[model samples]
Target: MAGGGGRSHGLSSSRSGPTSNLLFSCGKVAIVRTVKSGPNVGLKFHGCPLWPVSV
Candidate 1:
């Protein structure tokens, strides 16, 4: 049940609104790894179970 909130600043400010709220259950380890070495880094998901309908 741990979470956080913050405000964006500078050129990275979003005019559309804030980022999406990520909701996850307990015991889930969320790892957001860097895919690139630039200002905008890509993300890859790991250890998440796939749904039958989505597959």
Candidate 2:
């Protein structure tokens, strides 16, 4: 649950349109983020609040 907390702030502005209603298994609102590196760079996605820690 380390990644689930302390990351919910500063994300309200990112939620907009149809994607604003999306939610993950952790009951947290998904945030939109773009891949900064790797082969999927520049690809946009709805980031899970528990990322890197699994559901």
Best by lDDT: 2
**lDDT for each candidate structure:** 0.35, 0.66
The segments of candidate 1 whose C-alpha lies over 4 angstroms from its true place after superposition are: 1-23, 37-39, 42-54
True-vs-predicted CA distance for residue 20, candidate 1, Å: 22
Q: Report how far off residue 19 is in candidate 2 (Å).
A: 5.0
Worst 10-residue stretch by lDDT in candidate 1?
7-16
Candidate 1 per-residue lDDT over residues 1-55, each given as its tens digit? 1233553211122255545333234333333344466665685533223212352
lDDT (Cα, 0-100) at 2 in candidate 2: 30
Compose the digit string of candidate 2's lDDT tens values, residues 1-55. Answer: 1367566533443356654556665678876789999998998877876777855
Give the clash count for each candidate: 0, 0
The residue-level lDDT of candidate 2 at 55 comes to 50
Regions of candidate 2 where Cα sits further than 4 Å from its true position: 1-20, 50-55
lDDT of 1: 0.35
